[model samples]
Target: MNLTAPARRARRAALLVPALLGAAVVAFLAQRPLGGHRAGWNGWVGTVNGIVFLAAAALPVAVLAVWALARRRRAAGAEPGWARRSALAEVGTLYGTAPWVWMILLPGVDPGGPRRRVNLVPLHDVAEIVAAGPPATAAAQIVGNMLVFAALGFLLPVRFAAFASVWRVLALGAACSVLVEAAQYALRLDRVSSVDDVLLNAGGAALAALAARRWWRRA
Candidate 1:
């Protein structure tokens, strides 16, 4: 289905406008200093916020750089479509993933505290969050956990045939989540190592892969 020139321009604008607005928001947030001194839970929260902002601010530049590299590859006789898709997959995986990983690895308020928290029972932590009320925080926790691997799931299949299935994406997400949880435990980050997190992360990846199934099919 070919779009008329005006329709194509309109579609581009529709995508570009929101992206520009988002970049502006990220740039604004990145300029703000981390709140409070570097100590305690509040400090940790502030540091995470700062890191998130910085990552968001840098995302556009990273995307552009990847695009430029892909363009160069295309000029050097690489297939244009493959080059673009590969660049997007690479950048999306890194940009969407690294900040969350950093936040996860950052030591909690009591990094060297007496005990490292671990939740082996599946859904225990998730149940607690849901029952705790304050819908916003619960939603954020659930959604954020899901989004942690969503980009990887969505784009991995698009770039590689080996991961062109929802099950593979789910397994990949679970494996990565396990590694992160293990790091948190081994490093005594004071964060809970929860089976529920792995479940949610894998579920998110599977769902995202489902959404991208058409693209992956073409890939």
Candidate 2:
């Protein structure tokens, strides 16, 4: 008897979660209080944001160039297969989300000093922002939160057959949001951790995933 692909995946799932968690832990230790605001960097460009932005900008150009060259070499042969497309999607996914992740991970600096703030109640802070009559900031924040994971929501289903559902996107987005919020709270980044942020982020990802539903891979 041979194990099916899904069975193989399920077997590996046992190790995948722990491995991912371990990597996340290591990344948390290496980046925060060390590579973040606590470090000796003096400007935004010198920070993770600038570094990731440059990398993201360069990734597609490099990947596509190689892809093009390979296609050219096989001009009289079959086109590149799932391996190439999947690789592009994987690399692009990382490149697309790097900036947002970098921004979220960047340590916040309190203009006055460091302080921990928390907003546990849902919709409370969002309502205040809306009620204050500065609709622009509120609107931007809501949309920005959604856009943080928009690329992942839009791209994941296009490549991976398993993530081709609205619910999966929502779950993935929520999980990612929780991690980011936890990191902010844990790192004492002088930022308020809010439940509303998670809602908006997850909602945005779900909506974007729906928009890309047409391109979702059929299982």
Candidate 3:
């Protein structure tokens, strides 16, 4: 029997991504660190908030795009059937989270109080939470967050298939959100660390995975 397509592609992509990311990272680090609070153009990975957003939004698409291009140009030797929808789902889930990540990260709401915890997590009242606004609304932050994971759900089962379990994938996305919250809290970045995000983010992924599974069955 011929070698498994996914296993072959994974092995190859694994080899390729490090080189691409490493080159970008090295190029990022080579620049000089300039003066001031949040200084200089050279500081790539300058802010954890932006970095988190970039990872969530851009890296998934970038890596997948590179993989697709390679698959298409396979030098008459190695090739694999590449699915566009699966990749799009994965990319959308990730990119959708970017706005929220940036919103939290950027120093916007000035906590005028002397106390460390000021409670600026948007929906303060139970009544407001029930009202439900647009995805970008502070009250509806969960919408974008969930949509992304839903995409993740579809992509993981349809594309990645065997690597990450549906539950595990949900957990992982939740974990990343937790990590971001922790990093922001610890670093004292321009954001608050909320346990609520972990819940919302995970919920999004679970829903996404459910949708994805259903789609696969239909396909």
* Leading candidate by TM-score: 1
lDDT for 93 in candidate 1 is 83
Alpha-carbon lDDT of model 3: 0.55
lDDT digits (tens) for residues 1-219 of candidate 1: 999889976996799679867977975675455543444455434466667666767866886877797898899998977887788887888888888888778887799777899999988999999999798999999999998899899988988889998888999999999999999999888889999999998999899999998889353
Task: Say which prediction, candidate 2 or candidate 3, comes out ahead on lDDT.
Answer: 2
Model 2 Cα RMSD, Å? Answer: 13.4
Pairs of residues at least 3 apart in sequence or in different chains that clash in candidate 1: none
Ranking of all predicted structures according to TM-score, beginning with the best and ending with the worst: 1, 2, 3
Query: What are the RMSDs of all candidates, in order?
Result: 3.4, 13.4, 10.1
lDDT of 3 by residue, 155-194 (tens): 6665565624667767867887777677666555545566
Model 2 residue 205 CA deviation (Å) reads: 1.0
Model 2 regions more than 4 Å off: 1-41, 45-85, 110-114
The TM-score between candidate 2 and the true structure equals: 0.66
Clash pairs detected, candidate 2: none
Error of 3 at 159 (Å): 3.2
For each candidate in the order shown, give its overall lDDT on alpha carbons.
0.83, 0.72, 0.55
Ranking by lDDT: 1, 2, 3
